[model samples]
Target: MDNRFEVAVSAGTMRSDSSAAVRFPHRWTPGGVTVEADFTGAHLLHLAAAGCVLNDIYREAESLGIDVSGVRVTAAGGFDTTTWQSTGIDYSVEVSSDASADKLAHLLEVVDQVAEIPQAIRAGASVRRASSC
Candidate 1:
């Protein structure tokens, strides 16, 4: 079976309080952010990726002097039911900005490269519980 999950994270103008997802305070956007995802490991994994991309967009935009008004990131992936291992995660982005199309594109590219969570996922790590625990 495909244990797939999808999640979306939105900030600024893209934020929607209509869903049952939790809203968290954001440093970049005035209205904070909304995380639309269920409480599950698969959903949380996707949410981590999507939320990181959204945060990085705002951060890089400020560093580059891009006037971004909003950002939305949607991430999806599946786990192998047999091994309970991730199949990998994919994400998409939407941004509201007055910057030129090229600038926007470049900003996205930069964020894609620099988002810590995505990079960490790519690099891979060993996850294990403590012996004491």
Candidate 2:
């Protein structure tokens, strides 16, 4: 197996009798988690990073024989409007596990080096518009 996958999401605005809101549909997740339509582009970017890290923590922990009970990752950053580019991102990970501190730390360190989303961002992936409708 290639061990690689792609995800697609669609975003748009919806209007009801009371107000208009943004909607983002993530098809890859169970029930397709949706958030309030008020988030900025930067917020979504950071959210993807956080989600990837959290997922990877559990994956790596299981592979390393560490029993993880919980995991949380927070990713936050802002973009410069003038440049329309991300300024920087900061993330913190917290995990509840039965493993020793040293083992947990080692697992996190390995995940930090391998998590896909952050690595792609750090490597400066190119973005090009595919179509307009």
Candidate 3:
């Protein structure tokens, strides 16, 4: 995993109150969410995965009767300079919750298996320029 391509998203109690970054409304939290990633393709790609994981953490927490106060997800990977293809991605999860450690672990595991963006990237997708009017 390369720190050069890392992107992070934080929401709820995990979010920075002083960050100048504009916060986006998150369904799972009252204070919303903040993104710490650039607009580059690689940064955005990792941002998407980090954002999804952050969102699903809160979403699944509710369904499982766990109380999650905050979530921060970081994702990063390298790319082959020649072809610009991805080298692979790695992510880490930091959570704020009163739930038991085992419960928190279960929530993370479920989110990883179900988060749409990571799942899509893991399964792989074809990118093609679509013909448009």
Find the candidate with the highest lDDT and give its number.
1
| Candidate 3: regions farther than 4 A off | 1-3, 18-20
Over 40-116, each residue of candidate 2 has an lDDT whose tens digit, in order, gives 56667877776677667767887999876655466666666667667777777677777999999999999999999
As for TM-score, the candidate ahead, 1 or 3, is 1
**Which candidate leads in TM-score?**
1
Better of 1 and 3 by lDDT: 1
Error (Å) of candidate 2 at residue 40 is 2.0
Error of 3 at 40 (Å): 0.3
- What are the C-alpha RMSDs, in order, of all predicted structures? 1.1, 10.6, 2.0
User: Relative to the unseen true structure, what is the C-alpha lDDT of residue 85 in candidate 3, on a scale of 0 to 100?
Assistant: 85
The whole-model C-alpha lDDT of candidate 2 against the native structure comes to: 0.62
Error of 1 at 73 (Å): 0.4
Ranking by TM-score: 1, 3, 2
